[model samples]
Target: MLKMFISGSIANNTIPDEVIKSVDVSMDKNYVILVGDAKGVDKNIQDLLKINNYSNVNIYHIGNKPRNLADKNWKQFKVIIDESNPKLFKDGKFTRSAQMIKDKRMVSEADFGLVIWQDVSTNRFGNVQVSKGSLNNIYNLLKMGKPVGLYFVPKPDEGIIKLTDLTYFENGVISNMVNVKTKQYYYEMKSEYEKVETQKKHDKKSQGEQLKFF
Candidate 1:
């Protein structure tokens, strides 16, 4: 049973239909879904899970007090504050830092990440810019050798996302070409992931040398 961490940007109100179908298929395979109690995407996903009666879903919230508790029955993982860390606690109470700790732990515990993403220079939800944080989690999951099934929805009329999807290691093998639009998982792109990783390492090294020369 694959434990899938399902997360996305709060700025997204229009989630793609195909993405919903993909979640349906994943649930059919009994993949346990771990989601957070956030306002936009997370809340929407939970609404669908309730409508479909997906009982295997688990939720993580900032602290013992969840901002979104749509279901009272589902098990909630309270990522309590690191009391020993003064930065995380103010006046002996949990602070906003607990949210980030919860986010990191979600990625670490998952076997796979089913993420819905859209690229933008700045995505503001109310007043918070969230896309970069989601991007960071995706990269961390890739670095951990976990498969991230990314369902990317480009902004209307936009060409493509700027941040290229980093591919994971795949055994050299060939198969029929499917998923032409490339809206599905990127690893299906004919062994393209490893090549991207190689380029990224080279780029990093180049930057380091340039910095050293300064």
Candidate 2:
């Protein structure tokens, strides 16, 4: 069975109509859904599933229990944390690493992913002008050569722009939609991806050159 990972910015509390429609199609196909237990999109999606009485869902969390599991009968996949692990704690909080671990697990297990992102403002990185968690979700999915369906929510109450499905190509550029509304921010993210890919290529070339000297 196909597994679909659904994630979104915690800033949005309601799911858009198009996103819900896509979820409906997934349900019709009896796909196993992998969702988080965060507020905003996660909680809203759970509510939708609960209303539809859908049970083919797995709620992923960080600790022994989920923060928000709408369906008690649904399955749970908890990523147990080690408080003693220094990497798991940032600024005296485990929230960032815990969520990353959970999201990574979801991305690894899913065949494809759908991300609902809100473009409010740029983060410290100034690469993607969206929620960090949602941006990471998209990047992780793409880097793993998994397809992603992105719903870009623009600021000032603009409607959602459903970007074409994207799959990373080794020698090709990152794929993105061309809209005057989102073009600038999209290219900003694309530039960052290019930098990473370039670094990887340079590192490999350096390794090969060293082998020649050996």
Top-lDDT structure, candidate number: 2
- RMSD in Å for all candidates: 10.6, 5.8
Candidate 2's C-alpha runs over 4 A off are: 90-93, 121-130, 155-214
Tens digit per residue, CA lDDT, model 1, 105-205: 88898987866665332434444233544555676676777767666555323221222234322211001221222223333332465688889999999
* Per-candidate local distance difference test: 0.66, 0.77
Using all chains and alpha carbons, the TM-scores for the candidates as numbered come to: 0.65, 0.71
User: In model 1, what is the error at residue 27, expressed in angstroms?
Assistant: 1.5
> Candidate 2, residues 120-188: lDDT per residue as tens digits?
544567754436677667777877778877776653233433333343321222233223334455557
In candidate 1, list every pair of residues with a backbone clash: 167-193
